[model samples]
Target: MARLPVNHPARPIYRVLSGLVGLYILVFGVWGTVLTWGEPPFARDGAWALGLRANLAFALVSVIFGIVLIVGASRRGNLGHYMNLTAGVVFLVTSILMMSVLQTSANFLNFSMSTVIVSMLFGLILIGTGAYDKVGPEEHAEEARKHRFHPVAEVHRRR
Candidate 1:
């Protein structure tokens, strides 16, 4: 099998940025979990509740993706993996919508700013990861045919 070549011009930058964003997500997740620990009463009932729940769910998903990124970044192949991009897009859109609806008082400025910053960073990481994956090299497992192993390369190839 032919050896896979390095694909990106800034692959290392992508990996480092993506990993840093992933770490940020993990930290934000812990912070959010702590903040929302109690069954506090939500402000709105219908649309607001829906938005809140969706945002919460998306944040949780972001945390999961963060963990995946931390693991994926250490290995070969693209730093911004497919799962990371998918989750990041979902998170970015949902978060912006939720924040717009949830912010009522100036007291929430800090919270709002933090959310936007993190969401934007996540979006950038996602886009970068997607680009990297589109151009990055993948190693074949042909040499490992003697062993009973299914390679990640084959799985991604189908996509």
Candidate 2:
């Protein structure tokens, strides 16, 4: 099937979902760093197995991630969808794991219960926007009309 362009309005929503998620993460990372500054880079009150703290390193990464989304906002269709899909999956898993586990009293970006919920929502948005077909019926028919009779299946030649 012929896929619609990212901005085609036929299908694809990463522009908004990713932009929001990216902005949130970016802000969270910066806020976390500001709060945890002057403290250890890797503290006992950190998330993840490697004791990943919300210090300078994490904050930089977050900023960079945010910039990527904001800059790539105009990117439509396949590439954008795939990127968001992958990121969404990763974030979903990590967030679920973090929420499920009962660890030490540590706060990354001052995350509360609401934060976790928001993260979950973000992940879902990414997945929904990326995974599903964004093409509308009218657009699909138009595309069909344009490519009608064209061979989409590859033909193999015997040597």
Candidate 3:
């Protein structure tokens, strides 16, 4: 396996991840609001998410966010990382709050143990991925790998 640069980040990968998550939410939103004609964006249809019921409103908001994330991530700028960080943090918070803040019986949304874990995991990933942007793009993983064990061929001494 090749080694990654100490600071180089896989920004494109992170961008795609955010976009994919958004796509998933978009699908869920459409599925949830099939016939209600937007009556409930956050409705709890008693559907299970990670073994817990999720709110319809969450789905609606998720779809909108999904579009935002996808667009942001696709761009080659700091905005992509910003969106990833934002979404990631929100998911992380929501997951933790669902499992801890809300009552266990309140399965109105999948704030269950499963969602808590999954959301937290994804949230952290997004956060980590976004961080690369602030560090500034360095060298590619392969390029760094090539130089991993190599040392400077020559050293110049200034008098």
Candidate 4:
């Protein structure tokens, strides 16, 4: 099995980056909600928030997602790792799905091309953050580092 680095030296930086992303999303959602208030849930007219087209429904979902990401980024354990991973995948998948229906009535979120691009970007960032945020004791970290540098030897030792 592939092993992620534990107690990575850059974990703090990644966490802070993830938190910044969450903050952006949170602010975007709140701003979108305010700008799109009293509009139809999926109105595709001409409502833009933070450079992305949004509707009431999309803004509401963004609020929830933003909050989840913020909470996850604040956690100091594997919870953040797992949450980031999950959120990354969700963002990627949602972006693709929304992109496919960009010009169709089925685009309930009223997503624009810019939104898709931003979502994909955020997804990649979150995944990268998650990949390096795993925490472990020094022994495990040392073992993981060894395995990373000497895969064959580590594999043989495991067996």
* Best candidate according to lDDT: 4
- Models 1 onward score TM values of 0.52, 0.58, 0.64, 0.92
Query: What is the model-wide C-alpha lDDT for candidate 3?
Result: 0.61
TM-score of 1: 0.52
- What lDDT is reached at residue 56 by model 3? 66
For all candidates in order, the CA lDDT equals 0.53, 0.58, 0.61, 0.90
The sequence of per-residue lDDT tens digits that candidate 3 reaches over residues 1-159 is 533233444656666776776676666556644532454544545555323345666556656866786787677766766777787889888886787755655544434466577678878877876665433345554555457545552232222
Q: What ordering of candidates by lDDT runs from best to worst?
A: 4, 3, 2, 1
Tens-place lDDT digits, model 4, residues 94-135: 889989999988987888999999999999999999999999
lDDT of 2 by residue, 1-159 (tens): 544332345353557767777877777666766766676664434432112345555566667876665554446535666767777786688677657642545443323344456557777877766655343356665765556434542232222
Predictions ranked by TM-score, top down?
4, 3, 2, 1
TM-score of 3: 0.64
By the TM-score metric, which is better: model 2 or model 4? 4
Flag clash pairs in model 1.
Answer: none
Off by over 4 Å in 2: 1-14, 44-58, 104-112, 132-159
Q: Score candidate 2 by TM-score against the native.
A: 0.58
Evaluate residue 36 in candidate 2 and report its C-alpha lDDT on the 0 to 100 scale.
62
In the order shown, the candidates' Cα RMSDs to the true structure are 11.1, 9.2, 7.4, 3.6
